[model samples]
Target chain A: MKPINEMKLEFVSKSSNESFARATVSAFIAQLDPTIAELADIKTAISEAVTNCIVHAYKSSIGKIYITVQIFENGKSIIKIRDKGCGINNIKQAMEPLFTTGGDERAGLGFAVMQSFMDKVRVSSKPNKGTSITLEKNIIPRFIKNGQPS
Target chain B: MDVKIKLTGNTLTACIEGDIDHHNAKEIRECIDQKIEEESPNLLELDFSKVQFMDSSGIGLIMGRYKLMHILDGKLQVINIPENIKKLIKLAGLASLNIIKE
Candidate 1:
């Protein structure tokens, strides 16, 4: 599928990079002129996916996190976060609310938050192979033009 | 992210600035926990007035602190949370867990 706009970024799997990754994607999506709420949803969703890569996928080991964002006309976006690390053995269990491998430190709400904020969320993983999460959102402009809701 | 704590009598309020994610959630938790441990306030207030963004990690941070405060016989209050973040806190069913002051 051809994308109207696309960007790809690769960085080391470090916790500190989570904010950077989020900001980059948000900035890129700014061209779509999304509302503050819409943008926050996107950023929060991105943060969860990248955080999973750093905390669960690599598991204290250094690895690479690849993020690809594609924006299509008609206010739609597709975000893919991939990590080449220890993969999930049970995607079903992992997606369960309050089910987390990261112990008490994790709220186990990452996938839930993603699902709530985005239109669609898909996770594909294989043990020892890696995990890839795809998130899609349709950003409807919430602004008004000419003193009327557009 | 920046965390600033203030104490008034038995109330300890920590004002968190910037986005709350996995990157800074640990730090936020550690710093706030240390303050709570030292002061043992009757009420721990998290001021999100300056916070612009947050995710599940933020929710986790609040839940963990709620547990800590509960053990110490204290209550947790969330103040000035932005609209979007406030919606998320409610979506996570945290409204039943803490005091969310609009």
Candidate 2:
């Protein structure tokens, strides 16, 4: 297996810091030659994951979010978001759509949306030990009219 | 974020500006819900004309509004959805909600 190109970013769990994380991922993935829609999907997934950390994991408790991204030579990209805050007790229930632990205002579709946009999403949480989310996608190869990959 | 509210008869229009990601979605939900409850409008129009970006959080806001308006026997229409947002809305299979573009 070819070694993947990796980039790491760490930031505080601040609402305003979400953009910085998104930008960092975007910049790193831009090297992979993703399409516009693919880029949008990546950004959206990152936003959802980071937002979940800020709103749920941290829950007003100060913490840090560590994001690690790896781009494989085969155009496969993997994003790992880890948070050292309160962990989820029921990962399965939390992934259910519209099942929010929050008040009536939260739609609780964070995990669902992330699943929709990414090719693969996996979440692992240990009670009081924190949670980590891994998102992966394969960039579709562009082909020219001559039947050669672009 | 910029929020514009317009009243036409019993209908209320909310023009949202800027990004509607997780960071600001809760605030948007509260603001819109409060206005809807206060005015008790028979129709609500959400204008995404000026909205540059939105993620799943935006979808949650729209869905919540749909449920809210449904309980009141009112209607919700999304208008001027940007291309990117339109793609997302379609991806979410929410085009059936009667989102119109200008």
Candidate 3:
């Protein structure tokens, strides 16, 4: 489906940029006028995706992470996070809750959180090429008056 | 993320401020672990009232601390979490973690 609006961003796969990515995506998603809860969900999902690129894909080595956000007229949003670093060998095992190759500092719940917060999540990768994660969610429109839904 | 440690009696409270993410969780974890080693508190309290944002990295932070405390025969408790965070923690099934408290 064609998107009503779209944006793309690319940056170094640094851990610090994790929050940066979230803020950038949140700004673009703001055009949709998401509720606080919906916005938080998207932010959390985006953080997970970006962190995966940093920790698992690039392994803390410098690499490029690309992000694309598209908003649909049907109150839906799709955000794609892509990395050219080492890709996943097993998508299924990787998506499992509490499954992570990143020792110690990782909870292995990146995929799990992405799955939970978004309506749909699609992951694709090539072992030597790269990996990309596409996340989709619908924002229900609300009419507000005096800070309450009308 | 910034962690402020306060040791009172045998309880150590680590006030976690700022955002918790993979990037900063590393530093916060290291700092907290170092303090835990130094104080060897019987109970470690992770106060999150001031945390502005958190993702699964926050969960990882809690899990790592729980494991560390378990190994040291110490106890860990997470207090003053926001509603959204409490939901996420429940989704992670704190019931299974046993020692987890909100």
Candidate 4:
């Protein structure tokens, strides 16, 4: 389904931009009126995806990171994060938990955490070309969730 | 993110404040490591009361610190974690660290 509202953002793949991206997306999706936990889940997923673009995609030098967020009438948020940098050679290995090409400093749980929070997490990459990650989740309205008048 | 170090003889408590993410994890790790090397505390406690946000980098931070403390012949404890952050920890199967309130 086409999005009811959408946004596109482009920024240099800087670690500092991680928080920037998270905040921007959170603010934009605030219209959904998600519960606190739902918001936190989306925020964490965004942070992980952006961090991957920074630490893995553009490992050696800085590059551009593209992000698109689309909100649906069904209360689902679809987020796509892409980078035109070093792509993963083994997508399977990269997605495995506790697997890190980035070494010990990385928990290698980026994909796992995103999968845990979002309803769907899809990753596409081409070696020496770039990588793109898409995340989707539906936000349940508070009134329906609580099943009672406030 | 920043850490306020409280050294009381053999135990060192790091009161972390701010989001633990890829950008800030290195700084926090280095700061805590520096303290561990200097003080040689027998126990290191990571206090998470003030932290408001975190991601997988939080898991990495705790795992790396756990290894660090283990190598130094010290013990590490994660305490005062808010409910949300604790959930992330559990999702990562870090409950082995005994991070849940005891």
Q: Find the candidate with the highest lDDT and give its number.
A: 4
lDDT at residue B91 of model 4 (Cα atoms) = 88
By DockQ thresholds, what CAPRI class is model 4? high
- Stretches > 4 Å off in candidate 2: A144-147, B33-39, B71-73, B86-102
lDDT of 2 by residue, A1-150 (tens): 553689889999998877778878988998878887788788888988998898889997979999999998878899999998899999999998767876665667778878888999999998778899999988865563236956
lDDT values of the candidates?
Answer: 0.90, 0.84, 0.89, 0.91
Best by DockQ: 4
Q: Write the per-residue lDDT of candidate 1 for residues B22-85, one digit (tens) a residue.
A: 8888899999999998999999999999997899999889989888889999999999988889
DockQ of each model vs. true complex: 0.84, 0.51, 0.77, 0.88
Error of 2 at A16 (Å): 1.7
Q: Quote the chain B TM-score of every prediction.
A: 0.96, 0.93, 0.92, 0.93
Model 3 lDDT per residue over B1-102, tens place: 678999999999999998999889889988999999998999999998989889988888898899899999999888888876765787788658665565
Task: Give me the runs in candidate 3 sitting further than 4 Å from their true place.
Answer: A144-150, B98-102
lDDT tens digits by residue: candidate 4, B1-102: 779998998999999999999999999999999999999999899999999899999888899988988898888988898977867988888777664444
By summed lDDT, the worst window of 10 consecutive residues in model 3 chain A runs over A141-150
- The positional error of residue B16 in candidate 3, measured at the CA in angstroms, is 0.6
Q: Write the per-residue lDDT of candidate 1 for residues A1-150, one digit (tens) a residue.
A: 567899999999988899899999999998777988889999999999999998999997999999999988777899999999999998999999889989887899989989999999999998998999999998875454235666
* Chain B only: TM-score of model 4: 0.93
